[model samples]
Target chain A: LAKTTQPISMDSYEGQEVNITCSHNNIATNDYITWYQQFPSQGPRFIIQGYKTKVTNEVASLFIPADRKSSTLSLPRVSLSDTAVYYCLVGGSGNTPLVFGKGTRLSVIA
Target chain B: DAGVTQSPTHLIKTRGQHVTLRCSPISGHKSVSWYQQVLGQGPQFIFQYYEKEERGRGNFPDRFSARQFPNYSSELNVNALLLGDSALYLCASSLVGGDSNQPQHFGDGTRLSIL
Candidate 1:
């Protein structure tokens, strides 16, 4: 399983963009990076995923460099509700279990 | 459509007792996975079952076991529970198995407290 490292916590003001980066130096060639957001008492919700370059969705954007060693999750115009923990996962396309690190606790203040 | 659903949102147990948590996958989903999340920590993988068969197991001890039914639902059973076993038990389901790239839907989870 590929291990990921991210910030322990971050604080952002409301209406500002938040970018959380994760490092996976040992990521495999077939591995993909995925991001999820978790609110209190709720399961982690999928935010975005990308294999390389950039992938954007209605919720967020994922930017993966060509080296695939790292990726960043960008949330535009964050609100107080966006205050939650964000996890970045790196894994192959197999049945391997997901490995979640401590994750970055994002606090969006109004 | 309804997302993944878990039974008994909250459970309280005592040491040496046993407990079983249930999960129902989303419509058309065939894979269900179990995870344990302790306070201030991310979830730890427990088991992954696909098509009613075990596909993956985590480092948890034998006291932690799980099984899937023909309908793609799953149950996680733990015996000889210790106080350290207290945590939020989560269940996730994906449309297919053996693919980590695919997004898996998760349930709110069952809060189990060992007394």
Candidate 2:
């Protein structure tokens, strides 16, 4: 399992873009980076995933550099409803379990 | 289409008591996993079952156990429950082929409160 580090919290105003970055220095050759969002009283929902470079979806975008040691999750035009805990995970390979860090608390304030 | 489903949305138990939480994976999915989430913290993986066999388990104690049925539905059973065991028990499922890269879809979870 690749250990990941991320901020504890971040605050953003509604309609502003927010980006949360995660660092995984020991990322492996077949490792994939993924992000999940969790609201109060709900399960974590898949947001975006990527191996390298960049991957975008209707919800968010994931950007990875050549080093593969760090990745960022970008949410555009944030809203109050987007206030949630965002988790960046380094996918487990070869029967390894997916480990989660403390995660970034993204508060999309009005 | 129906999403992942967990039974007994909420439950309460006492010490030394045993409890079982049920989950129905999304149709056609084959892998199921269980996780425990305490307040103000990210979820902790408990166990993952593929093809009715245990694939992976976290650092959790032996009191935490789970099994996947032939239909891919799963049950998480906690024995001799402790107050600290009180938390949201989540169920997630993924396709076998997408085991590594595919995201696991989660159910709302069952809130277990131990007295």
Candidate 3:
């Protein structure tokens, strides 16, 4: 499994667009990048996923470069309800356990 | 659909005691994985079961055991629970296909408190 690095925390205001980046220096050829949003006292909710380039969904956008060593999760026009920890995971097939680093805590202020 | 469901939502057990936590996988999901999340930390893999067989396990001790039922639902059993086992036990289920990159869906975990 490839280890990941991300910011410990970030601050954003409501209606602002927030982008959090994650790095996996030893990314594998089959690894797919995924982002999950977690709120206090609840299980994580999937946001977006991508193999490379950009994939946009109703919830978020995942941007991956051709090298696939790093990816970014963009949350547009954030609301205070979006304040939560964001996890960036790199995995293949997606059944194996996802090892999480200290996730990036996004505090969306009103 | 119910998604993934676990119970009892909260539990308290004493050291030296045994406890069982149950999880119902999503309809048609064949793989169930368990994770332990300590306070202020990320989830740690404990075990994975697919098709009623043990497929993978993490670094936890033998005191931690799990089994998948015929129905594909599963249970995580901890014998002689230790204080270190006090944490949120999360159960995630995924379909058996390809590598594990399919983004496993999780259930609101069982919060186990060891006294």
The best candidate by lDDT is 1
lDDT, candidate 2, B49-115, per-residue tens: 9889999989899998999999999999999999999999998888768445777888989999999
Clash count of each predicted structure: 0, 0, 12
For all candidates in order, the CA lDDT equals 0.90, 0.88, 0.88
Better candidate number, 2 or 3, judged by TM-score:
3
**TM-score per candidate:** 0.96, 0.96, 0.96
**Candidate 2 chain B, poorest ten consecutive residues by summed lDDT:** B94-103
Off by over 4 Å in 3: B98-101
Candidate 3 per-residue C-alpha lDDT over A1-104 given as tens digits, one digit per residue, 9 for 90 to 100 = 89999999999999999999999989888888888888876777778888999999998988898899899999999999999999998882445777877799
Q: Write the per-residue lDDT of candidate 1 for residues B12-84, one digit (tens) a residue.
A: 9999999999999998988899999999999999999988889999989999999999988899999999999
Which has the better DockQ: candidate 1, or candidate 3? 3
Tens digits of per-residue lDDT, candidate 2, A1-110, equal 79899999999999998989999999988889988899877888878889999999998889999999999999989999999999988975324456778799988778
Docking class of 3: medium
Model 2 reaches what TM-score against the true structure?
0.96
Report the alpha-carbon TM-score of model 3 versus the true structure: 0.96
**DockQ, every prediction:** 0.62, 0.57, 0.64
lDDT score for residue B60 of model 1: 97
After TM-score superposition, the amount by which residue A71's alpha carbon in candidate 2 deviates from its true location, in angstroms, is 0.6
lDDT per residue for candidate 3 within B1-115, as digits (tens), equals: 8889999999999999999999999998999999998887877889999899998899999999999999999999999989999999999898777554567888989999998
